[model samples]
Target: MKKTGLFFGTFNPIHIGHLIIANHMAEFSDLDHVWFVVTPKSPFKAKQTLLGDHHRYQMVLEATQEYPKLEPCDIEFKLPQPNYTIDTLTHLQERYGDSRQFALIMGEDNLNGFHKWKNYEAILEYYQLYVYPRISGQKIAEALKDHPKIHRVAAPVMEISSTFIRREHKAGKNIRPLLPESVWRYMDEMNFYR
Candidate 1:
């Protein structure tokens, strides 16, 4: 049976922080592969700032292509916009079948609002939750105390984020160190988000 880890995010521009966490999860957890589920637009966030979906998807592909364990997924692209996590999970289960087990990889910050997710309780019942440490004021055990299928990962907390990189780039500053050299070159060649 193949164990798959689904890491969901807008990935406005895939950066080092996202890759580090995915790699960390694959290295430390029982997950055989980590898929970057590049969401078109998160319903929980403001939409005005989001880049084109294909652009974000390509960025993920470019950043993760070197790593065999990392895969960029566009599952949400075929689905409706403002895609729900539970819906994607359901689709994956039906498409991938029972021989494969799928787990949801998320930051502790999102756990606090987990209740607001569509069919949130059902998600807990159906899939395991892999939690990683986020900025602050979030703990895996405390936030997901009610959910039995929860796994608190001990991966390093990456403070870098695409938001920070985008801000720096927009400000005419350097973001070379914040992302992979290949990704930086791709963004530079295309003059993305400038």
Candidate 2:
């Protein structure tokens, strides 16, 4: 069976940090492929500040072009809005469970609030979670230290954030260093986040 890691995010603009983590998970973890699941709107995030779903999806596609194992998925686009991770996973299992084993890839910060997620316990029961380190995650890391389903990955922790990029771009600063060249050019051409 193909072991796939589902890295779900709004990816307002796909950045090098996102690529690095996804690539690291694909290489270092037991995952055979890492799918960048672009959600149209996340229940936990404000939708007004997000780039259009299609735009974010395209940016992910462009940014991940060089990585064979990294795929940009639009499955959530066809599903309901204010998407919940569990629903997406359930759909994926129904569609690909026969040939693929899906794992959830998330930041340790998300794990901090994992209990508040919709059907959180069901998620733990059904899928393995690969958590990467994040700044200010130590407290939650300690809290979840005994959770057998969550695996802490030794991926490099970069402080890069899409919110920071958006803020800098809106402030008329160059954000090239923080993003993939193609995604940066596309955002520039479209005058996004300005």
Candidate 3:
């Protein structure tokens, strides 16, 4: 069975940082493949700043076309909203069955606040967590530092963010280098963030 890592993000416009991180997970970690799970907007939230769900998914699809071990997943679109990680993980495992073992891909920054997530303990009990480095001031939880289920991956610390790219593009600056060529072309053609 192949180990599949689930990288969850809105990916308003999937960028090179996301691509590099996902690639690193697939190649450097125990995970054989990494799926960019494009998280949909929550219905309860009043803000609609995010791009359409399909638009973000398309960006992820275009960004990952060159990578054999990476792909885009829109499973959450059909699932009930206000979804939790545990729910998503359970659904993924059930959907794929025994053919693929699923794990969560996260950054060190998220580790500090992980205990607060819904059913955090259940998630740890059922699945492994592959955490990549991030430039953050907060420290990871003391008890989780040596947890057997959490694997720290030596991936690059990517400072780039989709928010930064959006701001720069809206300012008429060239942020093309931060994104994959296909993603950039698609965003440009759609007049996104401008």
Q: TM-scores across all candidates?
A: 0.94, 0.96, 0.96
- Expressed as tens digits, the lDDT of each residue in 1-194 for candidate 2 is 99999999999888999999999999999999999999888888888998888899999999999999999999999997778888899999999999999999999888878889999989999899999999882477465777899999999998999999999989988889999899988998999999
lDDT of 3 by residue, 105-147 (tens): 9999988888888899999999999999999889788889999
- Compute the lDDT of residue 82 as modeled in candidate 3: 74
- In model 1, the Cα lDDT at residue 9 comes to 91
Query: Candidate 1 or 2, higher TM-score?
Result: 2
Task: Please provide, for model 1 over 1-194, each residue's C-alpha lDDT reduced to its tens digit, 9 standing for 90 to 100.
Answer: 98989999989888899999999988889998899999988898888888888888888999999988899999999998789998999899899976889999998888888888999989998899898888887554464776568888988898998888888898999889988887898889889777
Q: Model 2 reaches what TM-score against the true structure?
A: 0.96
Q: Show model 1 residue runs off by greater than 4 Å.
A: 138-143
RMSD of 2: 1.2
Q: What's model 2's lDDT at 29? A: 90
Tell me the whole-model lDDT of each prediction, alpha carbons only. 0.88, 0.92, 0.90
